[model samples]
Target: MTHNPDFKDGAAYIGGEFVPIGEAKISVLDWGFTRSDAVYDVVHVKDGRFFRLDDHLARFERSMARRRIELAEDRQALKDILVRCVQLAGLTDSYVAMVASRGRPRVKGSRKPSDCANHLVAYAIPWIDVIPLEVQERGAKLLISDHPRVADEAVDPTVKNYQWSDLTSGLFDANDEGFDTAVLCDGRGMVTEGPGFNVFAVIGGGLVTPERGCLHGITRQSVIDICGKEGIVCRAGDLPRADLETAEEVFLCTTAGGIMPIAQVGERVIEAGAPGPVTRRVMASYTAMHEDAAYVTFVDTPTRFAAAE
Candidate 1:
């Protein structure tokens, strides 16, 4: 069970073989690469255990089903590959991703999606935060970008896909304005989500997040669960820009960063530019839940990896 020095940086499972992360590759002609025809899900490990592993796996499976991308590995096999990647990298805390991609078509010059082969690739790397630690400490500055999120009718937000034209454009605008990140809105100016996270607002002593045009993030659900346990009013519904701009407090939730407080939205600063008490409480509760047996699956490095190999 010794870790390979070459895999210290990271490890990957590809083409029925384990390899260093840098060696992982997909053909340029792949539909997943050329046309962004792929679905992926990320699950994080903290303190040598995966948080909500089953929930993430379920979501990953659902995404693949929705995209009609079938792979050789089933749910249990996918779990084994992810665990093996983490073990090979010798990482206690890591960011793991499971991806199902539409490969190149079987017949030459074929255009039908069904003709293309589908495959899965997975990797585990050092832990990462969507919002940097320092920014989270000071609370992030977010820009309400003019770029609107892709219409739900055209692209299903429920399935995790690689369609990020709107998100990337918004992020570019945010960076140019000297902000940390940006959140896109719907056609009617209702807030949707940020780059890789879900948005939340505390208004009039209640918590609200966008009910449409955003990913049903696992962390977002966790926050809602914490609110229920703590007797906090939280709901998912239409959130107008004006309401969000003048809210008492705002924060973001993602698999990469659990509860990230926001100091400013566009031009207005919130609570004198500091994380509010509600946010602090929720953050503490979220961190504590990592230790709860019901929510965690400890990494069985030796047992799982041996069986997987």
Candidate 2:
């Protein structure tokens, strides 16, 4: 790995220090890493600001409560961690991830004889530029996976837990099927979402996204909010595989990935080969909102510092 003067992939923060990716370690026996026992949240940075931090934190708290992973750092602490990570990376454009996992239950790394059931891991990385759609260009394709999404009973849909072998498996299944992503269904054979992102469709100029009992996407809510602002009718409900072919526009949303347009499903094409007018408008509007966020506050430096150096 090219350890740029500043960035490293496996490099991360733990116990308040920046360490080499190889040196910073977790246990083979730790519940978090070993069994994928944990939760995580990601915040997107555009023009040096985190989009919907409060909303992300709210969902994060919900994730924590879902698995009962106790943490010493609460909301304010989370906010501080987010800022510190961004500052450490010295990145003005990129995505930052804040992850908290259930600590090893066997009392391996802690002095407290009682037991440590959770741990917190946080880091930041400069993200690759998001691919934007060119007008009339065909969007990526998706394949329907025979495997369904993780059951709601095995894990609550809201928590961004680390137990994602099932999700990854779905992606692999899709790749093997020669598609870009995996469209997962519920036990009822109803389409839920693309492994990590929310599923959305445009049916007759109305914005339709799935309601979250399976995946609660912050970006999905942003899109819905943008639709409301632009005077487009919007709905959040179940969308089936059958509805995809007839839809006017279809897209996926996530923190790192902005709105992504889907060009085709199976042998059928969406309304156009590329992004529609509505998707373009929402993406533009969301960009404007990012500009007005708190982190965009003015920056100033001492004028004479360079002369002293």
Candidate 3:
């Protein structure tokens, strides 16, 4: 096992032990690895503070409950592990994730869910932005995916899971078409979401996003809150492909990057294929919130600084 020289690069808590991320391991028999039976959430830390920490934790708990997987650690205990993981990494800005997975089945060939134990895995690594800063500034180009989202009846979209086959295919389609990313639609041609982000559009001078068939992102909620504060007139409802194609502006929201503007959908140009006024406004507002004391959940920095004092 090798520990990376820079602590801020990689650190993880596997099973009941803390280890270098490169050293962390899961058994081949684990359901999470074999069948992709896992639920996880990522929370962003900026300047030693977690943004919307409680909201992320609450959504994670809901995802776990929906999957019928429970870890031995309670909310407070899990939060402590996350904080310690960040401390171990010595990262002022990081991307941290909490995962709960179905473990190896105990009865050898048993197919029952109860035959396995569930476990928690947490990690802290340097911050990541899904849409790079340069890309965001220039704005992203999205391919309206030919592949559709998996029916919500089969797998609830609200529960964060590892069922990404459909999304993966769509992303490949986007790449083949020479686009930045993809946005999926439902069977009826209603826009559902993108691979890792929620879709939003500025239609007829109003902001709208799909009401169903997408993960209820914490950052999406933050955008809505910002809209309410700024009086931007945002709403959630069915957004058709036609509306998206003809919209004045579009953007994606996720924890990795708060708000990313979209300049084109396939061959359609929006706001002259540039980040629009409303999109820029929301992005600015979301960015400013990270530095606001009200939105930050600070990590245990005092303990780390104690030895220095």
Candidate 4:
């Protein structure tokens, strides 16, 4: 397939065909659109290779299973589609997303979720940073938002769904207050996560992140692995807002931005407004892993396509 100039910015897959990202569309009635009944996952392609492709796909599958959304494409088909999107977009570094949406109910006006068909929609666009590069350089300023995260019971945090009212509201609050981003708590005063990233804190010489009320982010796992390999103590459990406030260092992790150090949380400054020693070490390790064969899937390799076939 020849590359289209319209797709130079982005490309998408929908209904078994590829199109320019702008041309991609879904029915307004699709539950995924109207009711936000969808589960999605993102995997970054850097330097023409996909980072932790298998892990991202596995998580995507798990999310779909949890939401009871099934599409006709299997794992291999999904991978091929995602690769094609990046190829069509001609992007060396791209942010790729695979989504499973609960389509409009076959029987009009049916409220039953089981009556709706499910399908996959995917796209690849330019690489994105949840926190801009310049902000990451000096470290981000965050707000402890007043809006609390939706309880895990109401909407499973483990499943990557489109339920973001609380997160978006918090982000608005942060921006309005002149902060770069925001993190929501569990109402009980336990820190949860930011809009698109997981929170981490270094306190008393150990690393701790909230074990609940947050998405189990791939980058968060990478940080945990890096800590283990580097012999730094890391644990996941209740991370109270007060404890986070007193942390010697703080950071956020996500697929889009990797490891981002925090310079300040609310009015308190961390590590004198800079990326701390441990945060810098982990960031370096995360960057290095992008080149590791064990963690990457090259995008242009015909062998990968053949294997998927």
Best by TM-score: 1
Q: Distance from true position, residue 225, model 4, in Å?
A: 0.6
In TM-score terms, candidate 1 sits at: 0.97
- In model 1, which regions exceed 4 Å deviation? 1-5, 301-305
Tell me the spans in candidate 2 whose CA falls farther than 4 Å from its real position.
Answer: 1-11, 20-22, 106-114, 128-138, 294-309
Error of 2 at 229 (Å): 1.5
lDDT of 3 by residue, 24-135 (tens): 7899999999999999999999889999888889999999999999899888777777887888888888999999999989899988888988999999998899878898
Residue 118: error of model 4 in Å? 0.6
Instruction: Give the alpha carbon lDDT tens digit for every residue of 1-309 in model 1.
Output: 224448988999888778899889999999999999999999999999999999999999999999898999988888888888888888999999998999999999999999999999999999999999999999999999999999999999989989999999999999999999999999989999988999989998879999899999999999999999999999999999999999999999999988999999988989745579888889999999999999998777454556645
Estimate TM-scores for all models.
0.97, 0.84, 0.94, 0.96
For 1-309, candidate 4 gives per-residue lDDT tens digits of 225448977999888778898889999999999999999999999999999999999999999999899999999889888988898788999999999999989898999999998999999999999999999998899999989899998989989888999999999999899999999999699999989999989988789998899999999999999999999999999999999888999999999988998999899888545689888888899999998999999888553444543
In candidate 2, list every pair of residues with a backbone clash: 103-117, 103-118
Each candidate's root-mean-square deviation in Å?
Answer: 1.9, 5.1, 2.6, 2.2
Better of 2 and 3 by TM-score: 3
Q: Residue 158 in candidate 4 has what lDDT?
A: 87
Candidate 4 whole-model C-alpha lDDT, 0 to 1: 0.91
- Candidate 2, residues 1-309, lDDT tens digits: the string is 124435444335565555544455677767676667678888776666677888888888888887677787778766666666565565676677777776666654664423765777777677642333442245867666777777778777778866666667878986787767767777766667776687777887787776643568888787878887889898887777677657787777777777777777656676555577777777788677677644242112121212232
Models ranked on lDDT: 1, 4, 3, 2
Candidate 3 local lDDT, residue 2: 41
